[model samples]
Target: MNILIVYAHPEPNSLNGFLKDLAVETLSAAGHEVIVSDLYEKNFKAVADRNDFTELNNPEKLNYIQEQYHASKNRTFTSDILEEQDHLLWADIAIFQFPIWWTESPAILKGWFDRVLAYNFAYGPGHYDQGNLRGKKAMLSITHGASSLANYGAYGLKGDLDERLFNIQHEKLFFCGMDVIEPFIFHSSTKEDAKEGLFNDYRKKLLNISNEPVIPFHPLSHYEKGQLKDQYKTSIQQELEMS
Candidate 1:
């Protein structure tokens, strides 16, 4: 299978980078074609701009933007933002590798989503309410500085790390019709003692993705019928208060 590994880390010598290398090497050694988008090395921009969205109606006036977009279309994109889309198109599975900063992804990875997963490419209520980018699979390979318990419900942390990513990784990706694959988290990846073991585990997981069961979204029957609005409202209020 063809795999695309999107790596985001400012320092190439960081633990996250080491895992990126391991993942790439392991995948290639297993006979899978791998593509790496090193956001920092590629100098990816972390912000979206007018050119990205403004050229939607006119293709002619969008000279530079079109070039970038086409490069992304054909897997030849050199610009950081557009290159991601191209890589996604060429891969069978998309793996995002990054260190969680402030309980979220690095700014560049966030920007990659902001720019690459655009209106027509990712989603819209039109087009039969189906997304343009469908039928793909994705997994997140993340590293965190904190201990695993810090992200679990037992310790009163927000919830499981998987729950925190539901909206972005699973819901968003699956809503766009991609088969949401289980994520691989390198808990406490920043610690030296844990790094080697976590890296080895991650490599094994990626290599054996075909054997893992694809987790489906929770059934709607699991939610209360009339209490949905109230529940979300309360959750939003609590989140605002905490923030």
Candidate 2:
């Protein structure tokens, strides 16, 4: 399977980088075509701008945007936006690796999503109503500075790890049509030295996601239909009761 690993750690010497490398090697060894988009290394621009929004009504401008779009799809180097779009199209699975900061992804990574996953490409009108990214799979591989248990929505803590990624995982990935796979999170990434075994175990887990329990797939239309599926309906109700 073709795999695109989008890594978003700033420091090259960080454990996040090491984990990324390990993942690359493992995936490559498994004979899966692996491409790493090292956002920092590539000096990838994360912000979107006016040039990105093509006006379809203006004939001259619409022609220009059409040219740009074709050039992008044809790989004539039309724009970075097209280039990233191409990568997503070529891959079957996409893995995002990053560090948790302020209960979210680092700025650059978030920016990557903001800029790259654009309208009509990732979602919205003229795109696949559901997961224009359909037939693809997505997973998150994140590291956090806090203790693992504390990150849980339960344990008198924040919320479940999955809850934290609801937007990016379900809303974003699923809306775009990618099958949302379970995430592999490592808590206390800052305390790696004291948790060598945990790191190894995490690595082992990362190497085995094909059979792992995936994050529950929640369709955006579910709510429109008035409620979540049976499993999630029960789980959410239970969560509310516990709270």
Clashes of each: 0, 7
Off by over 4 Å in 2: 53-78, 125-129, 155-157, 189-194, 225-232, 235-243
Candidate whose TM-score is highest: 2
> For model 1, where is the 10-residue window of minimal lDDT?
123-132
lDDT of 1 by residue, 173-215 (tens): 7655566677887665356786677677787797797666555
- Candidates' C-alpha lDDT: 0.69, 0.71
Off by over 4 Å in 1: 53-80, 125-130, 148-151, 189-195, 218-243
Best by lDDT: 2
Would you estimate the TM-scores of all the predictions? 0.74, 0.78
lDDT of 2 at 53: 44
The digit string of per-residue lDDT tens for model 2 on 1-243 reads 888999998887887898888888888887789999999998777655445544333345444334435433444332666677888999988999998888888888887787677555666543322646787888888887765566565753666766778878876777777776778777754454767776677667656756656555545544545566565665544666778
